[model samples]
Target: MAGFHVLTGSGSTIAHPKVRRIGVSDILDAMRSGLADFWDRPSHYVFLCLIYPVIGMILLTWASTGNALQLIFPLVAGFALLGPLAAIGLYEISRRRERGEDASWRYAFEVVKSPAIPSILAVGAMLMAIFLVWIFTAQALYAWLYGPTAPDALIGFIYEVLTTRQGWTLLLVGNFVGLLFALVVLSTTSVAFPMLLDRDVGAYAAVATSARVMLTNPLPILLWGLMVAALLVIGTIPLLVGLAVIFPILGHATWHLYRKTVVAPPERKRRR
Candidate 1:
């Protein structure tokens, strides 16, 4: 299979990185690798992974307000749009572990000191902008359909959503819009963050490379996205407590996926 080639600049020079075409097997392999990484020293991830449950709690708190009930689903679903940013540290840990180095939780913070922090933050800002847009769009859709006031109770709201035309319309249209946003995030960040961490490529190149990865292996990338979404939903089912495990596995898996998709640059030959 032909690989997708991305031309990225590293300061004074350019590098052509090849993104290999992957398959379902590769996805499974990556997941297994991720699981192994997580199990290696699961304790190392305990503190590092708490951020997810914290965010989940915050979202739940916000959604508890009667007026904000309409935002419950949107807030939870749209959180996935920022998953790449949340996993930056996990990627660093996986990177270190792969190199047989210290993979302690504290070392994950080392990404803060990386030269690519600017690029990583740039991409994170872009995802945050998209997440905000998704939230506003979902809110507008609900307001247009059901008016500004929420149903008096949670049960009544659920009943109306299942039985009423306006409710059905809101569900369909809102989810469709959310899916579009999700796909955009998946395509743009599938390998962008990890690439930035592993290379000197600027934000533009990293994003371009990620876009190419999606274009070249759309099926595999989409499958990977679905897997991530499914795992997230499972994690959310137990009152967000499951995320401590799910989040780390997914984060590590993403780094492994990046490794499988992108060919590492060749080592430079030094003159004797």
Candidate 2:
């Protein structure tokens, strides 16, 4: 994970963030390094984590009073899709700390002014689209399996899903569909987000580069995906507060992964 293994394969309009084969160790290392960055400014990540709960509280209010219980799971999964955007700030923090420079959260916001803004915004839109699709698909799956109406009581709904035979079907189908969407989001955004931040490249090129990274390192990439999913689920266990640490760690880890896996585009030799 420390040194680069430059990939010769090409994928986009311009391959600025050169691809490389990565292994399990690299992923873990990146995550560990990410955790290190989170501690570098724990207050910032705490702020990020707290902000997420207000939305969840609103959703909880809706679920308590309405039939919108189906929306909850997707919102959780959507966190992974949206992590790239959220991590932009963390990426900057990590970038600065790496260079022994000032690690300012406000400075991280300046990433928007980078020339990569168009590409970053484009990828952000793609993540948002996937999140919306996941939400609708989740709701549709619920309606198909358990009818459009959820139980008036949250405890009753949980009991039904856990104890009924139809509930098993719902879990099976819902997880299967969710896995499909997760793979799509993971493949496209895994390296693309960090790559865009580190390089000057078009959005399509950045996406293509990320796809190539997964293609070259399939098992490890899938492992990383599962880790993110697991972290999100675990973080939700404690009133969504654990996410304050976990989210930033993952974001910082992503930056490390990008540095480890992507070889910079080689400089063209000047003509004699």
Candidate that would win on TM-score: 1
Q: Which stretches of candidate 1 lie over 4 Å from their true place?
A: 1-16, 268-272
TM-score of 2: 0.88
Candidate 1 lDDT by residue in tens digits, 1-272? 00111223346434457899999999999999999999988977866797888887898687876468778888889888999999999999898888888888888888988766777887888999999999999988988987888666777888889899988998899889989999999989999888888886767778888898999999999999999999999988998888899999999999999999998878732111
What candidate 2 gets wrong by more than 4 Å, as runs, is: 1-13, 267-272
lDDT score of model 1?
A: 0.84
lDDT, candidate 1, at 210? 88
Model 2 backbone overlap count: 0
Residue pairs that clash (backbone atoms under 3 angstroms), model 1: none
User: Would you estimate the TM-scores of all the predictions?
Assistant: 0.92, 0.88
What TM-score does prediction 1 earn?
Answer: 0.92
